[model samples]
Target chain A: MSGAEDFLRARGLWRRKPRGEGWLLSDVRLTVRGGQRLAIVGPSGSGKTLLLRALARLDPLDRGEILWRGEAVVGNRVPDFRRHVIYLHQRPVLGEGTVEDSLQAPYRLNVHRASRFDRQRLVEWLRLLGRDAQLLTRRQRELSGGEAQIIALLRAIQLQPQVLLLDEPTAALDADATLAVERLIDVWMRQDDTARATVWVSHDQQQAARVSTKMLALQQGRLQGGGSC
Target chain B: MLNPTYIELDASRVALAALLILVNGAISLALRLGMARTLLVASARTVVQLVLVGMVLQWVFGDRPWFVVLGLLMLMTFIAGVTAVQRNQRRYPGIWTDTMISVWVSSWLITSFALLVVIRDMQPWYQPRYAIPLLGMVLGNTLNGISLGMNALTEALVTRRDEVESLLALGASRWEAAAAAVRHAVRTGMVPIVNAMMVVGVVSLPGMMTGQILAQAEPLQAVKYQIVIMFLVASATGLGTVGVILLGYRRLFNADHQFLYDQISE
Candidate 1:
């Protein structure tokens, strides 16, 4: 895989004090090239999740510039940029109805109107996760935590984002489910003709070593260099 | 075909009605409701405010100047907006300005449409007798609806911030992401008006209709007028609630469609 494709980059990224408090994140610099899986590891309150959210443009940044394919993501382009750079939380918040409803949500947005829900694609992912097409009709309440996370992953994965900013995507799962997720992501990253990337925030060191090709550590909102496993 | 002269309440009769407050105070004391002080203060405020309003209305009706009418309407709208804002336990950055504009635009549009197009008998359109009371009714009801809706909107955003952010991450614009909370708020604001409409005559006599009947208008005529007012009220409340939600949601984001965390205090 070519490592030359800088799919997403963040420069001088920091979060301002919302009120009178200190910065939650400061002077962070990071880049994710195509086919790269960068893991961010930190203790709680270390701003690991904050950094990922900022990259996805979900959180307000104090001062920063995020670029997609070397162009700054701004204004009317933010939605389009977001369509390709998705963020997933630890516990998914599902909309009302079956898993199918949650999967079909993005196509309803004007920014993603050009795309349609591909049930075949969803079934393919579900099959990889040891499920079948029948899982699509199950209500949100019926799904376990692992199942919910998988659905949330599929929701973003189906969108075919260039970079997936996952904030502990597998932290709430069991061992088998965790492996399933890791494998699903492996297949997903390879499916794109060009390189796709991920910034995974995980507290589990072993999992981090397994999933990430490169690693970064965050402490008190500052980024530091690290080694790949 | 009823007697045209309205039944006038003499000073004695008015005083007799004022004594009804004493009965309420006595009941509060006897029941140990701890509401006697509130009752006393509220009664005093009501008497003073209504008397002052009565004199001002008399003056407005006598001369019927356009500016004075418009000035009074603006003042009413301002007070309504502030009242709604004050109802929120937490404040957003520019919520006061947001609520004021929402209230004024919705109330003015609906009230004018009702007076001019629906009830064309009020020839000058800003005739103090019709305009003042009509504006007051619409503004008052709209205020309550907007307050409930604004409160609901804020609470939903705070509690569901995760869900909202998730949607935003999924290429949803600020509007699409916040659409659920907006719809919920607008519906909440209009629920009171809808409930009132449902119980208009069979369950209870609405205030305006009862007042019209007491003023010796034909009961049927009073009912017709009450229906018109109720329709105007529903329209105004629905519009005001929607305006406040749309504006409130817009303010929660910056120009770049990023959620403005600083704007949310709760």
Candidate 2:
């Protein structure tokens, strides 16, 4: 596999205090190449999630430029950028709806209206993730943490995002479910071309060792790099 | 020591309502320091404002014309807008514009439909004793429904914004994502007024009903007026609340169609 493509290119990233507090991030520079699985590990409140949010443009950056496919994207059009590269929060807040509705939600916005969603591929994804395709008709309440997450991942996958930012995607699942999630991401990563890149925040060293080809650990908000392939 | 008896217009009875306002006001004050000030100021303002409206009604009821009727409609709209923003300003940022237009159109059309078609000659185009108070009650209550309806719906939108954004990310339009919340709010908001309509005569007599009796109007006549006001309140609440909620949606979202967390967040 070629490690040459850069799906997300961020430079000189900074986050200003919302209420004039000190900067959350300052002079942070990073590049995430296409199809690269980078783990951003940190203790709670270490700004790992903030870094992920900045990458996705979900959080404001006081000064910096974030580019998707060489187009400048920052404060404005964060949601638009997200359409191409989805941000998966650890505790994903899905609405009061059936699984199918949650899956089809982003399509409801004008930004994603132009893009066509392939639920047919979703059927395969559901099955591959050890979920029942029939479960789409069922409400979100019926799904377990593991099942719900697979659907969340599938939601991101359906976007066909070039880059995916995952914050504790498997943290809510059990060991068995975590293993299954790790494999699903692993197999998909090896097979999917440079079009799909990922930056995941995980605490588990084993999970990190499983999917990420390279890992970057964060200690108290600074990058401490280590990984096993 | 003199014991105060409740008189319909007795300052004491009025004082009782004043006391209700004071008690509610103080609690409202301590609970919401900012809102407390607004409530007290608004309550005092309401008394002053309503009295001014009462005088205006005396003049308007003497004769009803195209301009006068059309103008009173404007007044009703104004009242509704002020009421909504004052009651719950947070949910309704920049709402005064659309709300003014909406409240005017809906309340005017519905009230007129009832008056012209339903209560044909209860006129001089306006009757302070009848039309004035009727409009006030209906408009005031409808304002509440709109405020509440908008509040609940926007809240649902905020709380479920992720679900909303997810829908938008998928393929749904902004309105469709918000459809559940807005529709639910409008539907539920109309319930108190609607159920009141259903049980108007037997379950409870509306303020206007007991009001007319106190004024020495015939019982049957009072019942008829009560029915009209009930219908007006129900229709006004339903029609006005729905319009306000739907119109308020566009303002609630940013250009990216994301709900403004900064604006709506507590």
Candidate 3:
């Protein structure tokens, strides 16, 4: 029903029995154009996280197709797709070192080992999210939920992926922390005009209204619009 | 050091050794009735197992065939895997992979050290004195090491998984994120051996030393051999424990560097 010029696209894709314990995921289609912020929200067990995994290709789908830059992201190439199209979960899985180690994470990974990150760049992002410089040198297990979420967001953004997927990025934070994360999300969408599209999942109505230009709510394994901005 | 007469171990001496056994057994029993049952089972099993081993050792040690050593080595691997499964709940894949790698590295290291380095002139039909007992000691210690390492690694993987993934997100390869946990686990798991090595002679005489005395070896000879075995246990524990954890963590994390959800089903 639309022109096929999107940067990230998924159509008619499904996944089933991923871990072989009789668990399954199917019927997932998602797309995000460069600079667009799309939120996919639904209750637990409605397959929101599974759909994210399927689209990112972290978990396999039994049917349909995912396209990155118009090429089918199927077969073994799914791994490459998942790598470049980043995904973040509710709890930030921070590494075992200082704040600085996490911020420079992408550059150390195999996929992005050639990339570079400067302290100032991270500091710039941190400052935008209203964080001080001391947050970077501190240990991983020492950070508060809000700081960790921001650091995780900062790490994901550092990858500069074509599309970023977030599942409940601030679900574990307080009201002030949630407000801070909301601002970070807002800043991240405006990070660069055509840098990376974002697909954020949340149940917060005010958040969905704040920064999301496009929205989809999952119900019984299908997406429904929620007053798109 | 004293060569107590054979008659020195008569009724009075027998009565004294019996009293030591009974005292240790009683204290062990008071630890817990359930654990007491387990400890008793372990003691009985050890006695029975070593006796059965003694029966096999006659043929194995006397014949000293390479094939016999090979067979024993395979049994060592099997025992290591079964022990790892028992400790780690290894119904899934990768657990065996870790154990196999650990056994290969540690057993080989200890065996070569024993045969080529320590007890040189390893006759084509090596003395079971040098080979069998050493293998049993190394294999048994490696089993405990691998189990402890697997415990530390899996616990770190499942519990602090978010930290691991975050490290990956931080841009660490699967290996780097896991290295912290692996290193942490290895340090923790290897502590008992490390501590034991540090405090060996000063605090208490170990079993190997005590056994050598029982067999009437000279004090100097027994102490020297005890040192060698203590080092062997530490080396095997350190290397094998680190090996299993690092390798296991690599498999647990995927190619895209995402920590696989449902990694541990049981």
Candidate 4:
């Protein structure tokens, strides 16, 4: 697992209990290589979200380090690291603007300054998700939950991140929208499967089986039943 | 120009003014508003505090040495800083020191500039009569601005945690992630001073100008001083608001470009 192919690896990851003694997420280890679809399934309050956030470096780790491409991800490299490894929140947070503005927002950051917003590319991606260019003109506040999730997906995908940490990205969508999201992600993965990967935190085991080739179950902040499906 | 004879108020006249609070007490009693005790305590506090301040100012103004003048100014700045922090509803580690730094730097910097550059005739420049009153006015206004700015910053950070983190996750630097909150806080801190400037003479006669007029100064001279005071206050408030808000932004985020929203507590 400690190879150049390993894109993201967590070793002995620990998150302290927000209050009181001991760990909320204890001594967890995992590896994600290119071309892999890893799914983390766990019950509610099991620190699944904590684990994903820790991997994204959005939250602090108590006593562990995360490596990106066999290099310790640390200060100064964090923004660039986050740029490449985007985290899609469960509930989308769109700024006050049209959908096109939300998509264009990332380019304004200094880390993404080199990347220009390509409207043609976004239109193509939206079409794959059964959305039209008209959706881009609508205000974000007018978006449905499912539409917002789709916008969130396109927002990350447009950046061309190597790893997508999906934290229940479709938990709020209907069956059709969920399938559309899955299809869009499937297309994203197939586009550059060798260099791109995704780690999904999902509640639906059957959906997990359909989307992922490897599964890891978490219970009480401990990893269990790790194996290929 | 002939010096105008200023009418002096005796202690009995001040007592007569104090008796007007009975009207407020009567209203409270009639409405059963449970505020009579509060009104009484506040009035008492105002009298005691002002009388004590008057004595202190008299001593300081009476040919005090430079060190004593400097010491009193420092004490005033420190108290103003503490008062600003106490008015805020949120608490974070090192907030006191941050507030102190903002209040001290902004008020002292503008006050010194006024004494040395603006006024230009302060014999020895640290004369207690000029320095003490100028610094007091600046500190008073800066205190309000710092308090408002700190409150707005902390509240926005807490309520907009998700929005901030989303920007962080999207690869925004700490400044980029917290820019909107900083802007909002700085603007909130500045609004009161800006509004006061908008209506300084037309809507109300400011206390300093009124005091100067009562003390037999020419009305035009008093107006000139009031204009300068307003400008000094506006600058001090702007600098202090920006300083405190930026300090708060540094506290809530880190060098790692992380939004440490957990550090803030209600």
State every prediction's TM-score relative to the real structure: 0.90, 0.67, 0.78, 0.94
lDDT (10s digit) by residue, model 1, range B34-65: 99999999988998999998898878888667
The parts of candidate 2 lying over 4 Å away from their true place are A1-6, A9-15, A25-31, A54-67, A72-81, A93-142, A203-210, A213-229, B1-131, B158-162, B168-173, B199-235, B246-248
Worst 10-residue lDDT window for candidate 4 chain B reads: B1-10
- What iRMS does model 4 reach? 0.9
CAPRI band for model 1: medium
True contacts kept of each: 0.77, 0.19, 0.23, 0.68
On TM-score, the candidate that comes out on top is 4
Cα lDDT of all candidates, in order? 0.86, 0.71, 0.72, 0.89
lDDT of 2 by residue, A1-229 (tens): 3547766777777776557667666666677877688877667776788788767665445688788778887334556676777778676666768988877766656666777767788888768767767978989988889877877877777776677788888888998877777777765676675767778888877777677877777664445542212
- Residue A50 lDDT, candidate 2, scale 0-100: 78
Q: How close is chain A of candidate 1 to the true chain A, as a TM-score?
A: 0.93
lDDT of 3 by residue, B1-266 (tens): 16663234455865575466566778867875445566567666866897797788777766666877778767866777677668774334767766887877887777778778886886663566677678777777877878877777777677786666545433455566677777878887687788888999999998888888877779899999898898888888888887887777767776545566466656
Candidate 1 chain A weakest lDDT stretch, 10 residues: A220-229
Lowest summed lDDT window (length 10), candidate 3 chain A: A220-229
**Deviation (Å) of B200 in candidate 3:** 3.3
Candidates by lDDT, descending order? 4, 1, 3, 2
Can you list each candidate's DockQ?
0.70, 0.16, 0.32, 0.74
| Higher-DockQ candidate of 1 and 4 | 4
Candidate 3 ranges with C-alpha deviation above 4 Å:
A1-5, A17-23, A56-67, A70-84, A93-148, A158-162, A170-180, A220-229, B1-16, B19-50, B59-73, B89-91, B213-216
Candidate 4: true interface contacts recovered: 0.68
Better of 3 and 4 by DockQ: 4
Greater lDDT among 2 and 4 belongs to 4
